[model samples]
Target: MAPRKKKNASQIGSVSDNLPHNMGPVPEIIKSEIPAKALKEEPIDSPLPDSPVAKELVTPAKVTPETKKKAHKYKLNYEQSPFPDHPLPTPEVAEEVHRLLSKEHGQRKAPTKVPPPSATKSGCGEVPDLLDALLRTVLSANTSGVNSAAALQGLIQTFGAVNGSPNWHAVSQVKPEDITKAIHKGGLSVVKGKTIKNILSIIHAQNVERRDALLREKVTGEPAGVLATSHLTQIQKDAEIARIKENPLTMAWIFEIKKDSEIIDELLKLPGIGVKTASCCLLFNMQRPSFAVDTHVHRHCKWLGWVPLNATADQTFNHCDLRLPSHLKYGLHSLFIKHGKTCYKCRANTNPGSADWKKAKDCPIEHLVDRELTRKPRKRRRIEDSDESEGDSKVTSVKRKSSGSTVVKPTKKAAKITQSKPVKATPSRPLRASAVKARAQSSQVKDDSESEVEEVVSEYDE
Candidate 1:
């Protein structure tokens, strides 16, 4: 190719010079093809066009403040409990009902006053110690007062008392069977005895740990000359052991607990102490405003419509404690027990035909009783015997053989034989030609020999 000549910078036409200067405003068709707003970039603060494209491109709105939601109210203090709250009668109605029951049943002795805050002792009646109260309450469970008292007496006599209190340390040391023997009069002795023994063991273990901690603190505080052995002298050990025996085993630490719920929780951790038992201890022993629901209380509360018909004893207690006034708890519990026992109409298993029914022909709170909710005797199903049925000719009744010299045996069922399917035989491999020919030749030779022998015998006969 030939060498090209270079043009001067000014001589060459620019792109703008090459374009026709007469080009008018953009055609309407071309303007329609391109978006007017897209032709130029706008600041972010500017409002977007009211179109589908602009709608997608618009910035997300500032999140609006969340509206407040209503808080849910729990019926009982324990929100997680399975039982639901039942409609409670008015406090006035409850008070009036209590009055009527008190009048009819005769008021029980008022519960002992709560001990002063400074006082360390807290117990019910003659039972001066917390441990004694618990044991007495356990003995009284599911038994008559006389029987429970006798059982307690039996325990005292069998174990022998130290300083007028049952030697709990000695009881703890003995076998569970011995304790059962001691409290057999209580009924359910085996269970009660085991429970008592376990409670003692747990308390004894805790007490020992506490004593050791104290001893360690004492030993640390003492002068270096005073040996650890001196602090744990044989005499001191014997005296400590005697103290555990003579002193009614008391859980004084429990009294130190401030909250009633916490005290009940601690008591529940011990063996055989359920919500009812714990409540009993709280009300009668600790003199707290805790309402206990026993069989009598449970029955009366249901009849009075204080709790749902299907409510369990623990459920009854939870609802009643919350619903009933603090002052009424002690009186109501005492009145219910007394009325349930004495009132013929309300008492469990009351005989309608009995002469004693006259004593309580008219219940004190008959109008208050929820007749629908009151427990009724369950109707037993009448089982009709097949032999007793008439007009059944095909039916042969089976008679149970009487116990005698001849023994009746159960007949065995006949066994069924299952038919088996025949198995298909597999074909055998073909024999070799040489082996076959050899067998044939041997048979032919034998036949020829036999014929020759026959011929010779014929010749000899001729």
Candidate 2:
């Protein structure tokens, strides 16, 4: 036996083969007409008719909640969501962004170095560790480091011993108060006095026996005693220079201090020997390994835009510890000082003249924003000449005169040229001058002959 085939929906004549088409289709029927609601008057639009309908024959409007509920639910899907054009963020991408702003979880940054290219340690003469501190202190007094240096230089010149480290120290040791009365021409006496004393004391100790042990160890001498003995030689040299320059006999007294284990520590213990001073001594005096940070160098570093501004000296130290290579530190520190002193200046908001000038100026955005806002753009304008004449060239519409009264329309301003123009100047001239003369003569002769004939005729009649 052959297998039965399935019937297609369109091929069916009746739903169950029980109803006839005239009565109404077995599965569907339409019993009424519907009017469109396009009419403005609501009363003319008819309500739709009711009808038994097959699922396929029903309009969407005819579907009821009950019929919809009975219909099977179906789902549709494509390769992506409905809005295939735009993409949504994924979890992993979002997670990466959160990590970057988390600064604390990140690595520590190396210290930034700014050079003080113009800062002059050369001809300007460095203060001894102690005198440098004192001068710098005085320089830092009520004014900035720069001002103090100016005052210190003024004091040095006013006094006679302005040659070098030894002479400068000699001058610093005397109380500026002692001489302010003598001249009253110099700087703040009592203040300069304390500062100078502090500097001298620092220099005195640096050359003596504190951390001098470490300094002397730089040589390839034996471990313990060899270090002390080498420092002994340096002490002798410093004392000799001091005595030869200022205190002629102070060397003998300084040798007594050479008995200690560490010259650098002893030097640091002096009145003005803070870290900067100590660092200065290790760096400048003994030429040892140490980093010295002063205001100019600190500020110049910030101007380089390498480090954030407002970094403290200690913070700068920490930064340098990380970033600066060990060997370059000595030259770098001095160069930074030089550059800052020579090139940097604190400028006002209105005057940032050059690169160096702007280094210590206020925030850059300040003037720029203010200038852009305060400035006005220039406008263009047109001027009219009030006295100028205007011509409106329209022809007149009123009736005009005939040829005789045509105002003889004097040919513009040139019409009174009678002396040069011929008379009877009509445009058509078919007759020649000779033809006009001949015609007049022939007419006279004919008139005479006619008169003669009339006379003869009259005589015969008589």
Residues 152-246, model 1: lDDT tens digits: 77877888775555667689889889999998977999999999999998887766665565455556764323212234654664455456454
Q: What lDDT is obtained when candidate 1 is compared to the true structure?
A: 0.62
Q: For candidate 2, give the lDDT.
A: 0.39
Clashes of each: 0, 25
- Candidate 1: residue pairs that collide: none
Against the correct fold, how does model 2 do in TM-score?
A: 0.32
Candidate 2 has its poorest 10 consecutive residues by lDDT at 453-462
Q: lDDT scores for all predictions?
A: 0.62, 0.39
* Predicted model with the maximum TM-score: 1
- Candidate 2 stretches with Cα past 4 Å from truth are 1-150, 153-159, 162-176, 179-189, 198-267, 300-311, 334-462
